[model samples]
Target: MRAIWKGAVSFGLVSVPVKLYSATENKDISFRQVHAKDGGRIKYQRVCSLDGEEVAYADIAKGYETEDGEMVILDDSDMADLPATSSREISVEKFVPSEQIDPMLFEKSYYLEPEKVGAKPYALLRKALEESDRMALVTVSLRNRMSLAVLRVREDVIVMQTMMWPDEIRNPDFGAVDVEDAKPAEVKMANMLVETLAGDFDPDEFEDDYREAVEALVKAKIEGGEIKAAPTPAKTGGEVVDLLAALQRSVDAAKTARGESSAEEPVQTSSPSKGTPRKTAKKTATGASAAPRATKKASVKKAPAKTAKKTAKKAS
Candidate 1:
């Protein structure tokens, strides 16, 4: 892969020359809007909102709008006058625990590879960071914009992950939420349910079921076959009247489904009889005087054991 950025990892007074390449990729299929009538490709043109006239590339200029519709246009030279640090350095500011960073702030990640002469130092730094379990906060300028990024060891390689600013995240405020007076029992039950369903996060087990279904439908259409829709699962019955009873029932069901009960313990049933075959109870050993039946028929042949007494009797 081609290097997207060429820079140096700067820490204290030391700088390690490195090259950055994207570490992840997206493989999603994309479609473009088209004109169906004439089968002509649709194209977009930039137009001035005030005049409603199409604007050429050369006619466009960056402008800042002030109060009362005042505008200040900035030319290329004016933009160049703005203070910008060199793009050749990834200036490290501080070191922090990787877990301290929120996942939402992460924007993109890139693998950092050292140049030929900097290989030894790169490997040493990556190993040291891996042992220390800390990430470096760094600033990198790319495409005329500066971004806050984290530098850390990804296995044997160094990785740089760009982060978004805090202001970009939307504030959480549940509008019109009716929580004036929630019942204590309801809250307790909800908490219990959540606790019961809690588990370690594993990204591999989750999938986009809707997207897969849509892709399957598209494939079927392309092959000139009918797409069969999956039947919707039956909706669960209404909420139970007793909260504790429901929770206990749910716990019991989950345990039974997972076969957590002992082999000797009989499973309790709450189902109504609907002509289903019932399992016959096994008879206790002492319940009846009947002897255990032999598995083989009485006429089956058996091998005779050799005995000293039998041999003596034969001699006599």
Candidate 2:
């Protein structure tokens, strides 16, 4: 597992240099938009709504649509002036009881591996958090943005999980979901039902039935000699020749379209081999009190033709 970000964890006068690796991934199978009659991928162009003409990638600039319906176009210089931090220190703000943290705030999880010289201090910090039964609230800069995260010990390893700002969590307005309480007999029966089903959670016991079924169906189709060969997507005028260059252009174009290059949440880094996230450590620490919800995972935005085709479809 290659390190995506290199930084140091600092608390009081102690500093532990560590490498950060994403601790989670998405396994959802993806499909693409295509011509059903033929094996060709559908493509899209960046056309202006008003002019109705395709726009060049170089001509694109970030635009912010105000609440009053005004478009505030911003150039590269404008975006450059926006406040961004790239600090390499994971500064600990305070140690708080683990239970105090709301699981809803967790956005992403990462593992921290100590540098050779900082091994002792890293273990000390992990042991301290475990002994105190607390989590170290920290501020770290990742991808040129400062974020709130927590450092806690999970199975003798220190894990850093980024958090969302309070305002980002919308308050539910269900208009008082209050209802009458159940009768004593009904409540007793409900408790009995709960006791009947109660058991320790072993993650291995559960499986992604939907994903497994899809895989099996695809395998059966392949065995039956059913397949379509998607033609290579044709490149437009002045397209980048190199794959890496094209990918970088797609990333930059996506950032420009969003009007916000700053990632609110940390995203996974590509692995050295198959592009999937990898772990070199013996095991991962995912049994922390504030386990990140699968729904909140974030991915780095990319906009290649194939990816854009997939993006146009409703997510699985």
How accurate locally, in lDDT, is each candidate?
Answer: 0.65, 0.71
The alpha-carbon root-mean-square deviation between model 2 and the true structure, to one decimal in Å, is: 17.0
- In model 2, the runs with Cα more than 4 Å from the true position are 233-316
For candidate 1, lDDT tens digit of each residue in 79-191?
89997766788998998897898989999999999999789778877887898889988989977788899988877899899999989988777776788588999999989
- In candidate 2, the residue pairs with backbone N, CA or C atoms under 3 Å apart (3 or more residues apart, or in different chains) clash, namely none
Candidate 1 Cα deviation (angstroms), residue 142? 1.1
Tell me the deviation in Å of residue 289 in model 2: 51
Counted clashes in each candidate structure:
0, 0
Candidate 1 lands at a TM-score of: 0.60
lDDT of 2 by residue, 175-257 (tens): 87754676889988999999999999999999999999999999999999888654343343333323333343345446655
